[model samples]
Target: MTEPLWKPSTQRIAGARLSAFAQAMQARHSELEGSDYFALHNWSLAHPEAFWQGVWDFTGVQASSPPKAVLEHADQLPGASWFPGARLNFAENLLRYRDQRKALICLLENGRRRTYSYAELYREVAQLAAALRRMGVGPGDRVAGFMPNIAETVIAMLATTSLGALWSSCSPDFGISGVLDRFGQITAKVLFAADGYFYNGKTCDSLERVAGIVKAIDSLEHVIVVPVVNERPAIEGFAGKHYAEVLEATVTDIDFAQLPFDHPLYIMYSSGTTGVPKCIVHSAGGTLLQHLKEHQLMLDLGRQDVFFYFSTCGWMMWNWLVSGLASGATLLLYDGSPFAGQGRVLLDAIDEENITIFGTSAKFISALEKSGQRPRESHDLSSLKTILSTGSPLAHESFEYVYRDIKQDVCLSSISGGTDIISCFVAGSVTLPVYAGEIQAPGLGMAVDIWDEEGRSLRGDKGELVCTQPFPSCPLGFWNDPENKRFHEAYFARFDNVWAHGDYAEITDHGGFIIHGRSDAVLNPGGVRIGTAEIYRQVEQIEAVLDSVVIGQQWQDDLRVILFVVLREGLKLDEALQQRIRKTIRENTTARHVPEKIIQVTDIPRTISGKIVELAVRKIVHGESVKNTDALANPEALDLFRNLPELRS
Candidate 1:
């Protein structure tokens, strides 16, 4: 048997929050007294009411009214209700700590830094909440933010949710149309934006786009601007108010609205790469409870830990990062490009700020490896403990690179979930050992399994990732999805009453889950199913191939796999490199997984949150229109793949 990459020592296991949680639960409910994680996980699924109630109590969730019952209609996926009769305020729970501990540390790409203590953060939110209250923003009102991932953005969101309002935000880099397509659907009453933001040593102005968004959305009543690029941005054309001016009322306290457990706290949007984005509404209690469980139990977060996830306001990880405040952990926020400072900017922050838990996308980690930036040899990383990665499958080589070059003792956890749940279905557990390329465990109480097309559970094989039972953090529903027709069709259409998460996945012998790729983007060639990640894992091992994207194209009578390569600077994809690519894939994977044609391109199109858009690229390859180019970070890259002369033969 192969050995794990790393394992927790006896002291580490004994000190883990999971161990402490298990001990406390066992004292109250004797059925959960085992030290085995899978045993505890099974008990959680079987007695979900007791498990969730234990989590709520263990985390000391600050609720206005205790839950009358833990769950209602527990068998229904869409109809199940959690903590139905409880009343709580999301912001109030997050802001429960008022001491002088550092709550937020803001780092910008342009060498700007700001820090906010817990007391200061609470005061800021109180003032902002008071100002929002005067504007008549109340329960069920929608508030929008077109800002960067700065302290102000978090403050604004807390203030909005404090008044029982729903908050939605997009990064400042989003185009005007993308902003309108999202905010237009919800008819937001207030908008907050930054004047401009810095990216890769370039200043990108956002006020012009904000003005355009204001004119397009007639429901907007107010626009507030924060100065980043300029001290006093010219807001002449638009009647926008400065962020500081709006908070001059000097209010020092907040009246947090104690709303229903299922009241809307946030309105997240889908990638919108295929069509208009779906506004996914998430409940306050569900989001808070699920985040507390993931943060405290899964990540082993504590008050002394400095937690950081490199995410923008547009991505769901930003929401996940902010929830660390509830656990009393300091949050580190970074804006602008992850590639700034020769890709050492984030690495430098780890040493400078003494970050304990660092989170980022799998693409960032791969890019660091490709750039030959070895932090183990370059920086002091004694304070760092865990690294969280998502947004795509973490290639197998990237896993090796981290233990080899990044840090030997750190836990590298590649988690997977989406905006659909606003949390992870399969995530990391501190109690588990680190494997080569696997998510450590299924989220407790998730009832996660891999099933074939017939809905029968499979072992050691690739299949659809499904959750037979519902979990908290399941979205309330899609906005304007009356009768839930579209919502049901989106998640439950494939299986009767089961949540069909659209991911091509496999269960490993270690009892961990490996996400191959998006199920919808699985390549079918010659009647054989091949996941793109399986090919990517092998191709990325070759140093010359900087990045690649694969798609199955229609041929004479069947589908053929086509590959596109993005070579390093001044390097060309000659015949030798093509043979090496095919040799690597054919030897590691099956011959059918090899691409029929290998073409070179300058760039690959990805979403604004940095996920490669395979479906959109496939549509472009087949001479079809990509409905929403605004959702892409580089829309121009799609043109490089169109009408390729090589594909004609």
Candidate 2:
């Protein structure tokens, strides 16, 4: 029973909704098991050409010229070109339906709300496209947005694509340096941003950061300011215009620029821990077809659903969540702190908006669980059908917490993928049964496998997570990296042609999967494999600590787990606190999982994007150089780690 494959329970998802034309091909192969999802998955992988071609045809994706085949280059994973010679615009596929159906639910930090219908959204995007065109925006040019997750941000992205301009963005919360490290690289010609944004009870202004970014990036030609809270700032040396004024003299029929299938639809960057940020360019056609498969078939997202992902414009979740509109679902966009004023802000939004698909990070979920938050018991969350968790590995305890404390019947999907692909390697499928702590399967088209240190395949055992071939979402290449050296070094260098995602995971007997932690983040105590998330699952359950990070310190030729905790407000980390942390972990996990030393710290270093920097902290504690402190939000925090009395032997 404990094999590397499991069958979905009764009432599985129907086979891909193939067109009559494609069905004839299936008919030619009568031996194929079309009804079984796994059978279909294996068949697609064996014939990658026919699988993607079917996806393009079924989605009705508009293209200027259909390609002769699905892939032009297959043997070379890094050089694969999907739908070669095809020309399509990403915004056109997203804006297909122009009826009065509600396209978006615009939310504010406070009590204000605004909704846009499909027709209204189209009109606004057209005006913005016209506005950008007047500002000298054209094909292959960069347009950046420093804005919140609201109507204008989505409009700006759509509008940029409409004009065949590349769209890139950062959330308003990004500090000047963080935003500059990313946006400064692409050399944006036009910038669209909000003056200020509200979160919790306080208003946060972006004017200063915007000014600094504009000053640093010499290519910025114009700034279009959307006043969300405060009056717009008057910055010198830049041509400025109001968003409303830009839309004033524009018509609603701006044409969608026809570009090749591989035209850059969006530009996203990697966290620059090692060096300069790598700008990942995605395609218009690939993004459209892939999102369609994820939304319509996997997620079953429909117009009846009102979706919301608690994310900022900077995160890829924002990119994924906004694509819900392409499924004709009303996406609920909230601009504020997710956990504000008692951690009930998102719950209130869910109740008020009746959000059907509510997504958040695993960190947020674990925090809520630790806080003893029971929104299902207190608030009305009946509208939510699925709860999605990602960013980090969602622990087994977190999975159990959702079913036991949050909602018993809701589908708890713990998905994992990253900025590199701009999509998921493993995600949810409503047609499949929910299991505790496991992602149901490798996303249908993904050829995901588990490999050990020797590069040999290992199933039903913890190993490295890898993908075998060129998936559509793979970044074309790193920007300014002419020889494609950086892109190859980042993913393919580990194992030639195979994408080493650096995640410690196992493929379960039932074809389900479990993520332990980042292979890089694993703690080796006495040379035993220990997932950092395992300690986190147990440590956060202690009442005194708000958060903690476990790192392995190399001492006397073996690794030891040293825990640093941030105590809850007004709490002291004394002997009693250490006892509680150790006891909790030992009782819940194993003896090796418990920390050897428990220390208190003011804060843990994280990227501006909210990823914990375990490697950074480990470097500091071991008296090694933290190669790039510039990537950290609080670089000065490392000073406390150095010369610690406890570190000296």
Name the TM-score of candidate 1: 0.99
* Model 2 regions lying over 4 Å from their true place: 1-31, 231-238, 583-591, 624-642
The residue pairs that clash in candidate 2, if any, are 3-509, 6-510, 6-511
lDDT winner: 1
Provide the TM-score for each candidate, comma-separated.
0.99, 0.93
Per-residue C-alpha lDDT of model 2 across residues 166-192, encoded as one tens digit per residue: 889888876777778888889899999
- RMSD per prediction, one decimal? 0.8, 3.1
TM-score of decoy 2: 0.93
List model 1 lDDT by residue over 1-649, tens digit each: 5588888777777999989988888888877758667877888998999999989999999998988999999989988999988999999999999999999999999999999999999999999999888888999999999999999999999999999999999988888888888999999999999999999899999888988999999999989998888988889667799998889367888899999889999999999999999999999999999999999999999999999999999999999999999999999999989999988999999999999999998889999999888999999999999999999999878888999999999888889989999999999987889999888889988999999999999998999999998788999999999889989999999999899999999988888999999999999887788889998898788898788888989999999999998999999999999999999999998899999999999999999899989888899899999977888899999999999999888
